[model samples]
Target: MADAVFDEETNVLLSQVDIEPVDANWFDIETDFVLSQFNLDNVLDMDVKSGNFPYSQTIGDLNVEANKTETGNCSSKRFNFEAKSSDVKKLQASSTPLNTQKNTRWDVNTWDDWGKWRNDRTISAGLKESAPYVLVPPLTVDIGAAELCHWMCRFILEVRRQDGSEYPAESLRQLCISIWRYLRDTCRRYDLNFFDRSKPDFADLRECLDARMKELNVSINKVKKQAKPINRTEEDILWSSVFSLNDAACLQYAVYLYACKLFGLRAADEHADLSVTQFTFGRDDVGQFIRYIGGRSKTVQGGIFHKKVLAKDIKQYANDSNPRCVVNLFQKYLSLVPEDGPFYRRPLATKTADGDQNTQHRRLVSIPYRSSCRECAKGQVLTASRLDTLVK
Candidate 1:
């Protein structure tokens, strides 16, 4: 009876299973179809017609033509294709990779600009054409330790803004570092011996930079007048004043100031980059809040090296009781602006009721703002300079 029951279960399971037989020639047919898509004859013909297959022959022909050219006679030795090819391959291997070349170009341009500035300054100072302090292209000149030190000292002491004000201590430090980096990179690229940290010159350079920086700081501090920090009471007064005003310009200013404080934004540029999409309304277990998703900033630049340093997501809870609540102000501001685009935009202008042709009033009007440039209508974002002016 047990054996009969087991057999009945096995038969039922087998009856439930359905298997379809595949054609034996299906694999062959599929393989043939894929192979047929690539015409070997056409590929070979194209390569031959394009003069690509016989790479060695093509290179030899080019070399022969080059040897017959007038510029080819400038070199003492005849053009050796094999040797030249090997050298080029080695250079390509040793040089900066294609992926990183974009960043290197910016550095190169900066270095060249610095060199030009140095030249201009030397000329203005009525120095001789052979002035040791004047900077030249790192790749073209071989800088010695003493020469470099002299140049750094002169640069720190002489370089000034258009208004003749001295550069800030931090700015001077960064400039020195950037120039050093350019020199170091040039040395590595051409296999030169200058600017190596292991050398005594490097040690002297470091000590000089440290000493100059300290001196600069002391001198700058003697004359530096810093702005007073806004106290909480002062802030309250300012906030109340801005909030009380029902004007469009005042509302925008309030929102900008509130956003800056809430988001812990320090630089004017950061505020300029803010947009509507960066903020979102969400509900948590406690209550409703406005969440801000941060991106690239002064401290946190998202890259492979900064993978561990995650972008910060900040939340500001809603305060219904407070008349000057950030959440309420933000919501009201959003309602006045478009659903998308920059957080801050140009204030709308409307004609006054008096019908004076020259009189116009600025107010919050909900409409898409267009850029002045006809070719591109997208760059309507508030600029850092304008933000600075507003803050002042």
Candidate 2:
């Protein structure tokens, strides 16, 4: 049911065939079913398809290439979420843009790269020159490029493996990397990329993303689709009125509200999309349900993090009697959570741009869905709820 489609209107990837909405988290069918139909299992652990890169070259003793002719999906200017790419014709990872002080995602591929271009030895000159006040003491929120670079480098290498396996060590790094990647993009739009770009080679990788962007730009659906996400304009919890009706839709919204207000978590990767394990209780601190925590984050780049789902609302919605298939990976066993898993998830956001609607559009509705799913509060629908409504 899921075939490749070329949509001339949006220049976004589409399917020759229509795919039914099995769920927001994953494909409706099992991976085995898909693999059987496409014979993909036979291709694993093998060489990838061949291709020609027109922009191949050498830079600073490293072989380089661009994704010049590769096809783009949701990363075009339309959405702006970036993917860790292996394409060559896109852009030079080291090609620092004019007027921009930091490097692109493609430029740095090793710890040595961090030492030189990223100013790993100390704080970034860029931060000191611009906002000196922000750098005077123990940097709290606004950070410099150097420290961020070092942190990101360390985190990435912690989980990065030559074997290309998503083992325990690697998964943690990926989760952190994924979280930081979305945060980086958010900061960029909010004028914070200088301190927020912690994604693996975001600066360098982004440099080589231009071609892919262009290609993807030519494949999306022009104009927002009707089914796009419907994000709100303010942090409105007015939906609490559903106290008496704890039905599926109401409970879903309540859980969404808790995610936005409580954890401020918003991610679209596998960890968030799937339902978390749950258990029932009585008059307990966790109330009725408890979410499964200790899962990995998608942007971990590297490093292990064990997060506890220490929230009240989340406990009520754990996968149990009223389970809505919501995933709660951070419940317990933080040590078991992978680094490359989704930190928070829901439906994909409506658009990549700063829009009120976060989940109205369906298919690749802007890269926000790829990055941060629509937040259920604080720019989500506003509603009032009786505390008992969430009790069960």
Candidate 3:
């Protein structure tokens, strides 16, 4: 009965209410017998008299608006992985409002604001007072279509930044496509038909843009390189230096870094609550292990569950405090953290008002110490952007 209601294996449940049982004649009970069990008079009862439903409860428009305001609140609490947004806000298409809202899930006002940002462009002077880069000295709406198209082509192919750096071929191709889209949108807005392929001017302009994009694609394909995975030697070198760092600042983050690598965990938006509450210690076929449960990482979204596990090893890396040992490092971190708090806290450091030139020399000679747990924010956790700096 529970499996029929909700299936864990399939991650699905019945959505519609079972108003009437389909297979009513079962266990010696006839369909008519089952129908007779119902109190037909209840249809006239006061409870049934109201034209309301059990499944849906009506709410005020104000409440609906208030709920909508909290829709994007998750973005604020997201981990700054790569310092970029990773939240998946899917676009939806709808009709009945006349099918005008195709892939219009995004707010129109927000889209307009972003479009303004995309349209804005500026060129800055570089070092040594170099000439500022410009695209055809800027054009106005009064400019002839032919002249505008000519300059647009010139901008796409020849223009460079103040630093004497031309746009990448792939990027320039995208820019060309965007310009074409802008032209179409503008024409549509003003009830013009300049983009009609049947028109001679439109066909010529389209051919020109298409040829330019093909040229860019050729260049892009020529320079394309395949990304390769990191080798064991490279990993060893990176981790060795990280674990052996003498500075307290380096050691402070080394523990978390080691743990991440061992458990195949991304140092970002994976764990919703990376506190002790999610941790579990148990034994498997490989012996004692630590498990992290219920973290909706990007690697496993949807209804899928992800659990990170660290198995106990027979051989320890070092007799003393070794930052490379995941088990030891995790235990140390756990001891410092409270029963329920952030697994990784911010590193601590004191600053001098008047810095000395011997700062580097002093750091080199300084003995590493444990990061002070007392200095950490009560409920705050380390972020991926900070992890990137530490890795660097």
Q: What TM-score goes with each of the models? A: 0.51, 0.22, 0.35
lDDT leaderboard ranking? 1, 3, 2
lDDT (tens digit, per residue) of candidate 3 on 1-392: 55465655665535643446667545555434567786754653534448553423333444686677666464555433443232321211111121123222222222343334333533233223353333332222444565555555545555443376555665555555444443344233232234466656445556665676677566654564432333455445445544433333454455544444444444343322355656656666655555655454434433313234322222222224534555555554454445675554443354334321111212112112113221232322333332333331
Best by lDDT: 1
Steric collisions counted per model: 0, 102, 0
lDDT of 1 at 198: 64
lDDT of 2 by residue, 66-173 (tens): 343232433464567554564432343223222121222222233234334444333554445564233222222455555554454343433333475322432333
Q: Report the lDDT of model 3 for residue 141.
A: 41
Candidate 3 wrong stretches, greater than 4 Å: 1-164, 173-214, 217-251, 265-279, 293-325, 348-392
Error of 3 at 247 (Å): 9.1
lDDT of 1 at 66: 80
Question: What does candidate 1's lDDT look like per residue over 16-122, in tens digits?
Answer: 55556888966675454666677676766678688878753444567788877756675546554456787976775444433234445554565566668877866
Could you tell me how far off, in angstroms, the CA of residue 200 lies in candidate 2 after the best superposition?
A: 25
